[model samples]
Target: MIENRKYIVILAFLLIGMVYAAKLFMLQVVDDTYKRRADNNAVKRVMEYPYRGVIYDRNGAKLVYNEPVYDIMVTPREVHLDDTLAFCRLMHLTKEEVITKLAEAKDYSYRKPSAFLKQVSGADFARIQDQLIEFPGFEVVPRTVRGYPHKSFANALGYIGEISPSQLEKMGKDQYSAGDYIGISGLEYQYERFLRGKRGVKYIMVDRHGINKGAFKDGKYDTTAVKGENLVCTIDLNLQQYGERLMNGKIGSIVAIEPATGEILSLVSGPSYDPNILRGREFGKNFSVLQKDSLVPLFNRGIQAMYPPGSTFKLIEALIALQEGVIHPETHIACNRAIINCHGPHSFPDLRSAITNSCNPYFVNTFKRIINQEVNPNTFIDSRIGLTKWREYQLRFGLGRQLGLDIPNEKGGFIPSPEYYDRYYGEGHWKHSTIYSLGIGQGEILVTPLQMANLAATIANRGYYVTPHLIKSIGESGQPLLEYQQKNFVGVEARHFETVVEGMADVVDHGTGQYRAKIPGLQVCGKTGTVQNPHGEDHSGFIAFAPKDNPKIAVAVYVENAGQGARAAASIASLVIEKYMLGEIKRKNIEDYALKGKFVY
Candidate 1:
C-alpha cells in the first residue's frame, strides 16, 4: 500500500508540471494576443502638435497667427491628490480653487480625461513644471490658441473654438475629437478643411504609475501631422481699418470691393467683439457673455442681416424694365401729390432725371408698364420667357440668391416673383399695382449690405463683376478667390449701361448725398437709400465708387438711425473714398466738420 501511494503522488506531480508547461507555451509561443493588449493598455500616446498656418492681407500684412499655450491635463482615475496644497501653490490658485476645478471636470466627464486648467501663460507653466511632479495625474501639454495680432477683423477672420457635440456628429468619428479646434464663423468656417491641419497619432509606452516612459517601439507606425495651409486675403488692410474707425459706435455694416476682380477690400459689422476673447478654454464663458448682449456683437450684419434695399433697388427695377423692352428710357410719367407723395411734384424728366431725383411715381408708373404685354410684350403670365429672363438677370447680378462667397454667415436676401405673388395674394389676384412699390426698391424686396455693395461693384465694372471672395491665396493654391473671377453678366449690354451710369453720376453731382460725397477731380457716382428699420428712425445708406473711368474701389456704408441716407452714411463713405484714392484727406476742414460737428436730423 505504501508503494502505490508513492507512485500516485509522483503521477500527480507530473500532471501539475505538464499543466504549467502547457500554460507557458500558450503565453510565450502559441498565443501572444493578451500579452500584447496588456502592454498596449499601459502605453499612453502623446501628440506632438504642428504649427498652424498664417493669414495675410492683400498687401502682405499679417492678419491672423498662432501663439503657444499650455493646458493642464488630468487623468482623474490616476489622480494622486495627496499634496493638494503644494499643487495649488504651484499653479497660482488656492486649495479650494483646485478642488472646484476638479469638480467641474468631473461633472463634464469622469470617463474621459478633461482639462483642469487651460491657457496658462509661459511664466505660469514654468512656475508649475518643476512642482507638477507632486501631482501624479496632472501634466502640461502644448496646444495652439488663436492670436489676433491686429484685433481688427473679428467678423471677417472668424474664430477657432472647441468642437461641440453637434459639430462632432457632423464631423463623424475618425475626423475630429472633442478638444479639437474648428472654425465657428467667417472665412475660417467657410474654408475649414483648408485652414484645419491633418491630424496625426503617436505611440507611447507608459509605466505602472501612469507616467510616460518613452516612444513605443521607436515610433515605427507614427505619422507626422501636417500644418494647415495659409490664406492671403484680398482685403486692403488700410481701407478695412479706416472703414472700421469711421463706423465705430454705430449699429450698421459696410462692405467694399474691387470692381474688376470682385475682391473684397473691406467688410465691417459694427458692435463687434474682440476676437481675443475666443483665444482659449474660457471661450465658453466669453461666448456666453457675447450671446447675451442686447446689441448682439456676435451678429454679422454685412451678410446675415437682410434689410429692405429701399431706393437702392430702383436701379435694378429700371434695368429689368428696360432690358425686357417694357419701357423706353425716354418713356414719360407725371408725378403729383396724388401719385407718390414725394417731397415734391415732378415730370418724367427722362430716365436720367428720374433716377437722379429717385422719383417714386416714375418707378411706380414704369413698373406697371413692365408687366403690360402691350408695352413689354411679356405680361407676368403670358410669355413667361421675358419674366424668366428678367429673373435670370437679377440672379446673375446676385440679387435674388446666394453669391457663393467665402464668408460663412452669408444669407440669401429676398427677391419677389409672380409665383411668390400667387402664394401671398393668390394666383393672378395681385396685379402690378398691388406690388408697384417694388419698382422703387420697396415692399417685399430685401437685400444684405454685402449684396448692395456687390451692386455698386457690378455697375462699376461696366457690365459684369466677379463674385466677391474674401481669401486671396493659400500655400500651393495661388489665390483663394480665383473661383470667383468669372464675369457674371446681368443681362445688360455694356453699352446699355451707359445711360444708367450717367444717371448715377448725376446723383452724386446733384442728389441728396451730393453735399458729402462729391470729389472735385473724380467722377464719383452714388445712390442713397433710407431703409425702414424696426426701431424708430430708418437706416441711412449710401453706395458709391470713385474716378468712374478707372474705378479703383467701390464702397457701401450704412448708419443706423442716422436719418437721411446723406447724413452719416454718405459722409462715412465719402471719407473712406478720399482716404483710399488720395491717400490723404485733401480737405481737413471737411473732415473736421464730419468729425467734430453733429448731423442735423
Candidate 2:
C-alpha cells in the first residue's frame, strides 16, 4: 500500500512539469505576437509626413507652397521627468500646459505617439532641439506648413488646420492619426485627396533612456513618402489681381468667364483678407478677428450671395418669349407709364428698341400677353401652364438651380413656379397681373453673380455653354478634366439669339449703358440693372461681353447699395473688359473714377 502511494505522487508531479514547459515553448518560439509586443518597448516607430502638392495659376505662377516646420511629439508611457519646471522652460510652456498635454496624450494612448506642441518654426525648433535629450518621452519631428507667396486669393486658395475630433472619427485611425493637418475650405477642401500625399514609416532602435540609437535594420524597413500631385488652376493671376484692385473698398463681387470654353478666369469677392494671416500658429486668432468684423470678409459673395438678377434677366425673358412664338422680333408694345413706370416717355417700340430702351411697361405688357395667350381653355390653367413653360426655359439657362460649379457653397437662386404661387395663393386664385413684378426681374427672382456670368457666356455662345470649372489640368500627365468639356444646350433655337444680340449691341452704342459701358473700338454688348433693396438704395448690376463677333470674355459685376447699374457696375465691367482685352488701360480717368466713386448707399 505505501509503494503504490509513492508512484501516484511522482506521476502527478511529472504531468504538471510537462504542461508548464509546453506553454513556455509556445510563447517564446512559435508565436510572434508576444515577440512584437516585447520589441515595441525598445523600438520607436516614427511617421514621415510627405510634402503637400503645389498650387499654381494658369500661367504657372506659384500660389501655394510648403515651408519647413516642426512638431514636438510625445509617448505617454515613456515619460519620466525629474524636473518638470526645466522641461517647461525649454518648450516655452507653462507648468499647467505641460500637465494638461500629458493627460491628453495618455488619454489618446500610452503606447502610441501624439503631438504635444505643433507648428513650431524652424528657428524656434533649432533653439530647443539640443535640450530635447533631457526629456525622455519627447522628440522633434520635422514637418512642413503651407505658405502663400502672394497673400492674395484668400477665399479661393483656402487654409489648412489641425484635424478636429469629429474629422478624426470620420477618417478613421488607420488613415489619419491624432495630430494631422487637413484642408478646411476652398480649393484646398475640394482637392484634398490629391493634395495630401501618402505617409511613410521609419523604425529606429532606442536605449533604456529613450534615446534613438540608429535605424533598426540600416533603413531596410523604412519607406519613403510620396509627394502630392501638382495642380494647374484656370485662374489668371494678373487678371485676378487687377479685379481685386478694382473692387477695393467696395461691397460687391465680380466673376469673369471665358465665353467659348466656360473656364473661370477671375472670381473676386470683396473685403478679402491676406491668405498669409490664416497660416502658421496664429491662424485661430486671425480667424476669430475675421469672423467678428462687421464686413464679413469670410463670406464668399461670388457664388454664395443671392441678389435679384434685376434687368440683367430681361434678356432671358426676351429669348423665351421669342422661342415660344409669343412675340415676334417686330412685335410692338406701347410703353404706358401709368401701368408700369419707365425712365422716360416712349411710344410703341419694337422688340429691339424696347430692349435697348429698357422699357418696363413693354416687358410687363409682353409678359401679360404671353401668359394670357389661350393655350388652355381655362384661363387660370392657361396662366399656370404658361408660367410653368417660362420656368422651364429659365431653368435651361442655368437659372433657378445650382450651376454645378467646382467651388463649394453655391446657392441656386430662387425662381418661383406655379406650385410656389399656389402654395401662397389658392390654386385658381392667381393670374398674370398678380405677378407682374417678375417682368422686370424684381419679385422673388434671385441669382448669384456666378450664375449671371454664366448667362452672359451662354448668350455669347448663342445657345450652349460648358460647365464652369476652376481646374485646367491635373497631375503630371496634364490631363484635362473631361466632365467640364461637354456642352449643355439651352434648348432655344440659334436664330432667336440674333435679335437679342443686336439689341444688346445697340445698348452699348446708344442706350442707358452706353455712357459707362462703351469701349472705344471693341463692340460691347451689355445690360444694366438697378435692383431695389427695401433696407437701402438699390443694388447696381451689369452683364456684358466684348467684341461681339468673336467674344473672348463674359463678365458680371454687382455693387451692393449702389444707385444705378450704369453709375457703378457698368463702369467696373467696362474697365475690366478693357483691361483684359487691351492688356492695358488707356482710359485712366475711368479707372480713377471707378476707384474713387462713392456709389455705396
Candidate 3:
C-alpha cells in the first residue's frame, strides 16, 4: 500500500512540473505581448510632433506663427529621484507637485510616459535641459506654441489647448495620444485638417539608467516629421488692426468683407483679450478669468451674437414687396402712428423715402399687405402661408440661417416661420399682428452681425454675394477657395436693387445715416437702425458699402446700448471703410466718437 501511495505522489509531482513548463512556453515563446513589454523597458518610443501651419493675411503679413516650447514627460516606474527638492527647484515645481504627478502617472500607467509639466517656454527649457540628467525617468519633448505677432484677432484666430479625453477618443489612438494639443475654436478649429500636420515616430534605444544610446535599429523605423501646410487668410492685417483699435473699449462686433470677392477684410469682437494670454502655463488661469468676465470677452459676437436687424432690414422688405408686386418703388404709405411709431417728419413717404427716413410705419404697412394678401379667407391660415413665402425669401438673403462661415460657433439667427409661431403660440392661433415687429426687423427676426455684413455685400453686388470666408487660399495656393468664388443669388431682380441702392445712398448722403456714415469724396450707401432692447438702451446698428457704382468694401457694425444707429455703429462702419478704401482714416472726429463711446441718445 505504501509503495502505491509513493507512485501516486510522484505522478502528481510530474503533472505539476508539466503544467508549469507549458505555462512558461506560452508566455516566453507563443505570446508576443510580454516580449513587447520587455522590449519597451529598453526601447523608448518618442512621438515627433509637427510644426503647425503659419497663418498670414491677404497681403502676406504673418498673423500667427510658432514659438518653441517643451513638454516634460515622465514614466513613473523609471523615476528615481534621490534629491527631490533639488529636482523640483530645477523644474520650477514644488515637492508636493512632483509626488502628486508621479502618483498620477503611475495611476495612468507604470511604464507609459505621461506629461508631467506642459508648455515650458524656450527660455525656460534651455535653462532646464542641462540639469535634466540629475533626475531619472523624465524626458523633454520639443513642441511649438502659437505666437501672435500683431496680438490681434483673438476670437477669429482661435486658440489651442491639450485635447480632452473625449476629443482624444474621437480622434483615435492611432492619430492622437492623451496630451496632444488641438484647435478649440475659430480659424484654428475650422482649418485643423490643414493646420495640424502628420505626426512621425522615433524608436530610441536607451540604457538601464534611461540614457539615450542611439536610434533603435539605426533609425530604420524612424520617419521624418512633415511640416504643416501654410494658410493665406482673407483678412487684411492693416484693416483688421485698425478696426480692432476702433472697436476697443466697446461691447459689439464689426465684420467687413470685400464685396467683389466675399473675402473677409476684418472681423473684430470687442473687449477681446490678447491671443498671447491663452498660450503657456497660465492658459488655464487666464481662460477661467475670461470665461467669468461679465461682458464675455471670449464670445465671438460677430458670428454668434443674434440681434434684430432693425431698420437696415427695411431695404430687404422693400425689395420683397417689389418682387411680390404688392408695392412698387413709387408706392407711398402714410406715416400712421396708430399702426407703428416713427421718429421721422415725413408723413407720406415712397419706398425710397421710407427707407431713407427709416420710417417704421411704412415697412409695417408694407409687411401687412404682403402677409395679408387675402390668399386665404382665414387670417391665421393666410399668415401661415405668407410667412412661409417670406421666410423663403429671407433665407435667400442669408438671414435666419447659418451662412457656413469657416469658423466654429456661428449661430444661425432666428427667422420666425409659421411653424415657429405654431410651436410658440400653438398652431393656427397666431397671425401677422402677433408677429408684426418682424416687418421693422424687430421681434423674433434676428440676424448675426456677420449676416448683416453679408447683407451689405449682397446689396453691393446688386443681387448676389459669395459666401464670406476667412481663408483666401490653403497651402501656398494664391487662388481663393472654389466654394467662396461662386456668387449666391438672392432670387431678387437686379433692377429692384437699384431703387434700394438709391435709398441707401440717400441714407448716407442726407438721411438718418448722414451724421456718421457719410464719407467725403466717396459716394457711400448705407442704412441705419436703432434696434430696441428692453434690458437697457437701444442698440446702434449700421450696414454700408462705399463708392456706389463699384463697391470695394461692405461693413456692418452693431453696438450694444449705444442708442441711435447714427451714433457708434455708423461711425465705426464709416471709419472701417475709409481706412480700407482710402488707406487711412482722415475722420478723427468719427474715430474718436466710436472709440470714446460718445453716443448721444
- Of the two candidates 2 and 3, the one with more favorable TM-score, higher being better, is 2
- The per-residue C-alpha lDDT of model 2 at residue 315 equals 90
Q: lDDT of candidate 2 vs native?
A: 0.87
**Local distance difference test, each candidate:** 0.78, 0.87, 0.90
| Candidate 3 local lDDT, residue 538 | 94
C-alpha TM-score for every candidate: 0.88, 0.92, 0.91
Q: How would you encode candidate 2's per-residue C-alpha lDDT over 191-244 as one tens digit per residue?
A: 888888989999998776666778987988999988888888888888888888
For candidate 1, lDDT tens digit of each residue in 1-601?
Answer: 9999999999999999999999999997899987776764566666666666778899889888888888888877668788767677677789888888888877877756778887787777877787776677776778888788777878888888878999999998687877778888887788787878887778887755556677788889788889988888888888888777777777888898888888888888887878899777688889999999999988888888888887777777777777767766787777644866664345646787777888878777777666555534435454233345555777878987888888775899988777777788877466665776776777887788889889988788777888888877777557655577678888777765667778788888987667887877878888888877776788888888887787888888877777777777778887878888888788665576555425564
Number of the candidate with higher lDDT, 2 or 3: 3
Runs off by more than 4 Å, candidate 2: 1-41, 208-211
Better of 1 and 3 by lDDT: 3
Error (Å) of candidate 3 at residue 427 is 4.2
Top candidate, metric TM-score: 2
lDDT score, residue 593, model 3?
78
